[model samples]
Target: MEELKEELLSTDGKLDFAIGFKGTVAIGFQSPQSGYNLKVIRNTPTEQYKWGVFEGVPSVLEKYGRVHVINRTGSMLDNIIFYRVKLERAWFTNALLQELLNDASECVTLQGESLFFRHLIVQSKLIPLPVYLENSSQAESEAAIINLGHCIKNNMAANIFNKDLDARNYGVGVFGGVYLFDYDALEQFTEVKIRTNQNQFEGEEDIPEWFFEDGVIFLPEEIESGLRIPNRSLRQLFREVHGDLLQVDYYERIQDELGVGKVPSARVYPERYQIN
Candidate 1:
């Protein structure tokens, strides 16, 4: 851990760019000895709840295309925690990365004031999903969207739910993999209530039912819209490829399977690789 701290303090650790609401997420030097770059996330002392939630994530999530966490360390004196993740050298740089980083950095205080915090958590990095979508070919975009569905299903099968299904929270990797990168809004799948607005309205009811739900309620039909895909055709393609995800019955079935201790097999490999 100290070695990581020292390495981060060196000249090589200066961030390429930093962004995030819960923390400062930046592309930074991987290691003094390594040639490629990595990602570094630093959170303030007050956000320990966020860290606790993230730390509890099962290691099994890696198979679902969650970021590969490398290390986690913190500093009581400096009032910050650090997370590091490995990243491949970017295939291409997109302005969106900088734009989002700039937006997220608006409220940043830790690095702006320059009281360096030595603690961190590390993991592997992938190209931000929106960036990849904006830049990749049509075929690549379709493949990524499919991977996104598989990623979500894999997590759901493991009884996890990403409360924020935004495209910004996902990324694409060198292997054309789509992965969930953010965890601040993660929740237990079984703990959430899946409902549809159709149940609450007969013809034209004014009051929305979600206003009355106790906690973590989700409208399955809203899942695709929640993703906020930028392209219309791709969004329609998402519906075509994974429309089952947008059904209450589908989620209920998954819950039932879990209740029976019959977790569905995760599709960890490419679709072509069948085990039969």
Candidate 2:
């Protein structure tokens, strides 16, 4: 079966023009009733390559069912590309994706060259967890953190890992569950040994003493460092529920699971990705 369709986008899907980066993914419309905000991928070879890598990622995510992921993607005139997934929105919805299918609705219009389409758009109504945790109760924070652990476990069980495992890369979905949205560093580890920090600390030595394996990155230690939030209590709460992720034993169980009989269906990916 063919993996990608060669159909020409209505025009914007081609992304022949650059988009303005003046705004972050956060949604802020001048009116409360303003139509949905779009997150367009800048027209650049780098973004195109990155976006290309994500072509089938959403399909894989859809099978996970409960996981929040980008919803749909396609192109319009000018080769502009767009995704039903907005980088930032007050709420997540699948309307954008479905709208694209209705030729009569004019869900979006290509007014000029400054905007493009996003095949990387999503249908998640969840907000970023870190931002939510900042204004929420300790209970909420703990729940988010715990749910995050669940999210990680579920994804890993499916044989995938987010190398950039940062808190911002994840979001709390409309269902009150945390899910990952970023794919810039997604990878598989069907046989890769999880990387761990060496027992020694970094000192005057030029090279950091962290351990390294052939192609896999140990994610536990990095999670503690990268996913840690600013709130003291939230961090403490996460420690209570997921402190194991910072240790080797946490990964040992996964390693053992894979060794015994876990289906090794994932393709082994390189530790580093090279853009050619």
Candidate 3:
């Protein structure tokens, strides 16, 4: 983490162009000493990336002073590049923050259960996105709608479930609501499947039978292979930062909703199944 900080600081004032998807280029920070403020100047897929930036909000400016520079990291399974940077402000206020913190606290208190959770943190809150509510009478409702819309527009649903969703990757302002940063994981999907024919599957064959008998035959695989499975090292880091909050069973219901076993090729929906 220190190394990442150092790298960010070193590129403070400089601006450099980094290639992203086929025709896109991200404007990146040249040096870290310049302080928090970042921007992605260019993008492809019909300029959808620009909407991630909220427009006309004072609180956002009060928080993160300027649009310093953007930093492009690598791509995730979803093909969106990740970038880590610092911002001017230390914190911001929002209902989402309170809810998230409460959830985190509850997860920590309910330890000892076998559950799966993701660890994400607010590195900085000063850098605000340019989102605002058009309906003054319905500020809260507008905020929720915009935030949810932004999440869906940027393919964040996949990342959120996958546990790779970074708070810095999205932000909520006073009446402006949520704005998305980092477009890397947008539109990516990960599927889990049970391997039934492998040579090592002899003893595991019964697992599928049990899952099918239990009416969970739609689930592709166990939590181990889920799209958001946290790496052992990352999990350890989460435990250190957020304690038992990283051990909650947030995905259990979703997993159950998806079912427990893989659908046989012959039985899969014709539109979804591919023939080799």
Candidate 4:
């Protein structure tokens, strides 16, 4: 831990030695063997703690750390939170990450967080949604969509709700599967409610059909809204394969299973990445 802290402190907000991914918060590197990366996201206390404890307990991500979401652990440096995350290597993530090396990777500017790193780590290998939709082959996009469904359903079974459902938050894994590595928007599944019915309004009153009394979490619509992939053919393929993700009831059903401890199995590795 001390060594890692020293390295980060010296970097001075630059990913000089790290590979960047899509999200402004995370960064990564390919281990000579296999390992994780670094993330500098604007996070909440819970998100911060999730990282701080993930590596130690193996609870939040171990039993449930399938390919859908990369494993991560949080830490503090100079009073600011830093999350060290496992690298994304599920064949597809590598493919997408490599593609981004030239023209896909983008940099964002942070306004006032001076001690905060100027270049947020994008090394987690999560492809920006636009790039994935615009450049990925149809088969690849379809695979990511279906895999994302599995990721979400399985997460609900484990009682975790990933609040941010933006396409940029996901990465393509082995066999073009989708994996979400961003942990800033995660929370307990049961803490939020699903407003699947928006028919309460008399007309197009412009009022929100979905309402959340709690402001600390993300609504199901956030996930639903993110379903709109850029490519029509790719979006259609996603619809055909994982349409359930478009509806709130799908997650609700999985939550019911959790209530009875009927958590579904989320395979940690896709068949393509499994050791034969």
Candidate 5:
């Protein structure tokens, strides 16, 4: 940690980094002596300690085969954590660093000799799911969509709800592995309410009951449309293969299992690998 801190402080204006959404900055570097490539992301700190983002839920993230947070340590009340992420695959974030730098004059001004980050998360680079789908072959895109479902289901099995379901919140690895990288909106499934709008509204004046409900309320049916995947066939493929994800019963069933102390295991591998 000390070595990394010293190196980061010394680089200052020489460091290459990109500004991302929700006040994140992605920085990549390689060790000259060890020849190891490393990447880190600086996140906006929250008022309270986050179990999943901090020391509390590494086990859960690992169990679900999510990004492995190598190390997290930092000062500054605003930037509380600095993470060292594993560099196992290619990375493509929300926006290209160059484009963000071009538009962000303020960030450009800040990237001088004294640039410092108070919080950081180190992880492999990932192609934002949307970007991957837009550029890849239809077959690969199909696989990625399926993997996205796995990522969602895996997190749900662990009782974690990624409050944001947009495809942009997810990333695709070069090998077709899809993972959720954003943790800002994470919440416990038990704390979230599952609702439906199948026959609730009659007209524009008919405000749904969930409209008045407090806390996180999720309408399962919206999962498909909420993703906003552009490909019509790919979207249909997702619905056909993982259609259960759009049902209130599916989420309710998982919640029921949790309520009965029957938490599901984090199955990270393909079923074909399972030994009978």
Candidate 6:
């Protein structure tokens, strides 16, 4: 285990030196791995702590940590990207850590970054939602959704500068009722609209419909051009981490209420040089 720990913390690859949970144990190797234990939890970094936020407001949740190590080879990215990796940390417990290890291995293999896999560390103390739940109810469900939205909005407002909330990344727990746990796709911009402008579509495109059915904020052009890259990316990440337990379509409906109309494609896909 110590050797494995050293391998993960080594600076020979694209990983940026195990940023969170320094000096933690590696419990992932002790259990039968599964997808339920592999997802990354999201938290807002505070001004005092390396990752801090306001107290008592419940700003922490589980999320798919963005894959900063794109090609492996010990390289790292300076901006947000859509990818996630597997890792094991003592903080995740034996069962959860094993799942994370297995999932990370699969992710690295799929992305063709097997060499860099050696450096992946399952680090952090953030807990999972299922492990925290006690019961289910309508009020609990509503609170969960609201809290999840707030968490997503808070993170977007603080880091990515966007208000586009992806509610699918959140789930309901027993005590907290609702919580968020993925962050691999988080951006540092104010709005997803600023990054891409092709989302605007003809007629009443129904952006909320896409959110309800897809659990994402789809731009008009993204649907028309069949370029659902963000959707595909997020689906891939969560499917691997949560298996089929996540209810995707339920949240898509919730997003449909953000208003609808023909929006300029440039507002959603700002970088496209040519339109079809």
| Reference-based lDDT, each prediction | 0.56, 0.45, 0.29, 0.46, 0.56, 0.30
Please tell me which model should have the higher lDDT, number 2 or number 5.
5
lDDT of 2 at 262: 69
Report the lDDT tens digits of candidate 2 across residue range 42-85.
22223214223333434433333322332211100011123442
Q: How do the predictions measure up, each by TM-score?
A: 0.65, 0.54, 0.23, 0.54, 0.64, 0.31
RMSD of each: 9.1, 13.1, 20.9, 11.2, 9.2, 18.1
lDDT digits (tens) for residues 90-205 of candidate 6: 22344433433453443233223222232333422232322222333544433433343344333332233122223433343333533333434444332233213434475755
Model 6 scores worst on lDDT over the 10 consecutive residues at 262-271
Sum up the clashes in candidate 5: 10
Give the true-structure RMSD of model 4. 11.2
lDDT of 5 by residue, 1-276 (tens): 455445444543222332223323233433332212233332323343233343323332332233232211110001123432221112223343443334332222223323222223444456677878778887788888887887788777777777768887677655666777665456777889999888765665777888898888999999988788878998899899889999999999988987888866454543233478
- Which lDDT value does model 2 have at 217? 53
* Candidate 3 per-residue C-alpha lDDT over 179-237 given as tens digits, one digit per residue, 9 for 90 to 100: 44444333212232222323336566444443444211222223223212133543333
lDDT of 4 by residue, 37-148 (tens): 4433222122323223323222322322332342221100011233332221222244434433422233222223222232323333345445665677765656566666
Residue 73: error of model 3 in Å?
24
Estimate the TM-score for candidate 4.
0.54
Better of 1 and 2 by lDDT: 1
Off by over 4 Å in 1: 1-13, 18-118, 200-203, 208-210, 270-276
Candidate 6 residue runs with Cα over 4 Å from true position: 1-117, 121-135, 161-168, 171-179, 194-276
